[model samples]
Target: MVDERTRYFRRLRRLRNSARRWSVMGGGLAAAAAVLTPYAGIGLADAAWAAAAGASVALAGWRWRDHKALAALPAPPPPDPALAGQRLVAAVERFPAGRTVVHELRRQRTRYALRGSAVAQAWDRLDRAAGTLSALAGRLTGPGEAAVLEAAVAERWLRDLGQRVASVERAIPLSPVDQRPVLASSHDSLAGQFTEGVTAYERLVAAAAGYVAEDGQPVVDERHPTLTRLIEATDRMRGIAEGLSELRRHPAV
Candidate 1:
């Protein structure tokens, strides 16, 4: 299937072609009209030609306007292994994700970080995952087909899961004596899920790294070895953290 980027560039090429045709047709018509204008009222042909001269000039100018737009819309590189790796790594490097997340946590946001807690452990796991992604970014852009596409997705899931885990961890310590037992259960649930999510994240990364390097063709999404399962597992952990935090705020009587 043609991806959106392919369709988009196709459209631009079509427009560029159209503009070239109009410029040729319009310039010829305008020249004819100019020659005809000298003989206006001499015959019906000259009058009609002069009357439509501006239309031709306008068509010729279409090329100039469209050229600016075409210049602005540069086509993406053709699909290849290097481009694939570049895109995935760029996503990993972008806002609130990957190595950026690791740097932000260490350099700026360490104040709220609870040492040796589930959140802390999750962060450490994320650090390792980021390292794996960094290697993949440099070495394994793609084969942009199948489960390989989900590599960035898995990292994002782990990142989001970390946010939710942090939220729940913060709320856990502040619970009242009566709610400690229930809150502790919720915290343990988060810890378990985080461990599971990170484990799967690493395994999935391992498969992807090996596959592109020398392993073999990866399975498609339905049978993708690890991504879907990791996504679902990470999603569930996020829900647990979010729900636990909400319950702490409005405890049931």
Candidate 2:
């Protein structure tokens, strides 16, 4: 998929081309009218001048709308696949089969990342979570421990994020001319929420790294404060997902 920066630049280039075309056309028409005023009847020259003025006005209006739409769009976040991977590894590390699970998840993530689409990567992460959860079902039933619970929470959040990402991907291409503002707003809001979620996940992962286990059970650290951050992030992501869902339901006309 095209990155936001590339998409924005492409749109800018198109707008510039359009403006140039209109300017050239308007100037040519005005020059033709001026040259013909001496040879042709004044009435015909006046008609040509009016047409030229109309073209100029149309170009101005188009530029104004284009500028507003472009300004309304949110800037894309910088790529941080490394950081995102670190957080994912940290979250996976909280499980007993950390090595195997992390390896598989990383492998899947890498495979999809190589596919060259953000939307695909998001879906791959969700697939990883689903696969992991399926494998953990038998083991989780044996005990009700903090580590197991944490894994479950992380999986759910990953799945939720994936769904939201999918919704955004679908809504993006359906944006109509009249709905540019709403689409831009939704894009901005989703980006902000996704960034916050990633940050929270990173903090949770860091805290999990320092986690201590007693008698094979995970112990909580008062100083680390991981769970609260995770919960907050998950809630925010869920809310954003719902908002995206709403957008999909009432797509821009």
Q: Tell me, by lDDT, which candidate is best.
A: 1
Please count the clashing residue pairs in each candidate, in the order shown. 1, 0
By summed lDDT, the worst window of 10 consecutive residues in model 2 runs over: 207-216
Residue-by-residue lDDT tens digits, candidate 2, 1-253: 3456767777877876777777677767767777766643578657868687677858856875786687677867765778667777777788879977777766667455435334454455445444544454444433434655765686567546645655665566688878867876775676556545554544544344334223235355543457668988999999999999999999999
| Residue runs of model 1 more than 4 Å from their true location after superposition | 1-114, 141-148, 215-253
Residues 9-111 of candidate 1: C-alpha lDDT, one tens digit per residue = 7777776787777777767776886776663344677767755666756865776677668768767766776777767666777766586665664534542
- Which one is best on TM-score? 1
Give the residue spans of candidate 2 off by over 4 A.
1-144, 213-253
Clashing pairs in 1: 85-141
